[model samples]
Target: MGIRATAVACLALVTMGCASAERTPVTSTAERFLSAAGEGRGGQACLLLAPEAARSLDDCEKQIVSVGLRAGAVRGVDVWGDEARVRVDGDTLFLHRFPDGWRVRAAGCEPRAEQPYECEVKT
Candidate 1:
């Protein structure tokens, strides 16, 4: 391959690697959020939430801790573009990718009847 062609191929490989890397951070963010909430570290949990999600609550620090969230083994993770959903035991979490990293947009979510998952905290 020509120099330009080789450079493009290398760039493509690098981009692919970066794309897959998102999975780790996304899963970790969700897990950390749940762990913090479960452990009664409200401040740490709030830090993992999206800015809008955090602001949506009148008392994020107090309310987030009392939402009955729990940390369990991650059952599954689906990442598409800037959005991600993680399933942890009985709870489902939705996250949004931000400039800095992924942040939880919703947590303590449960299935509903033909509707969006009902969430205890959402943006």
Candidate 2:
């Protein structure tokens, strides 16, 4: 798959997807992540990321804080099972529900024509 497709594929799986109450927590996680990043709290932001997504970067803590991520008004949310897509005023985020709570798997994402969202951070 193309690099962009990776982000969407993770959201495309659903044999029995439905509107979920998990939206609130999921959106909160994404908001907190962006808030931390925008505030230069790299460690805190990294704490909210999925493990693999965190490890995907050579220097996750440093890179995550510098990616220009920002918290904005939440525009929409779509949740399916453990996965979620949250649209903010200026960004798109993907998240997963871990055993502890919801964590971001991708952030600072944007869609291309027919391609998956191109994410600034992803696993």
lDDT of 2 at 47: 96
Where model 1 places Cα greater than 4 Å from the true spot, the runs are 1-20
In the range 26-80, model 1's lDDT, one tens digit per residue, is: 9999989999999999999999999999999998889999999999999988899
Could you tell me the TM-score of candidate 2?
0.82
Candidate 1 overall lDDT versus native = 0.94
List, residue by residue over 1-123, the lDDT tens digit for candidate 2: 987798677666442242444676887898899999999999999999999999997888799988999999999998888889999988999999999999999999998999999999998
* Cα misplacement distance, residue 46 of candidate 1 (Å): 0.6
C-alpha local distance difference test of each model: 0.94, 0.89
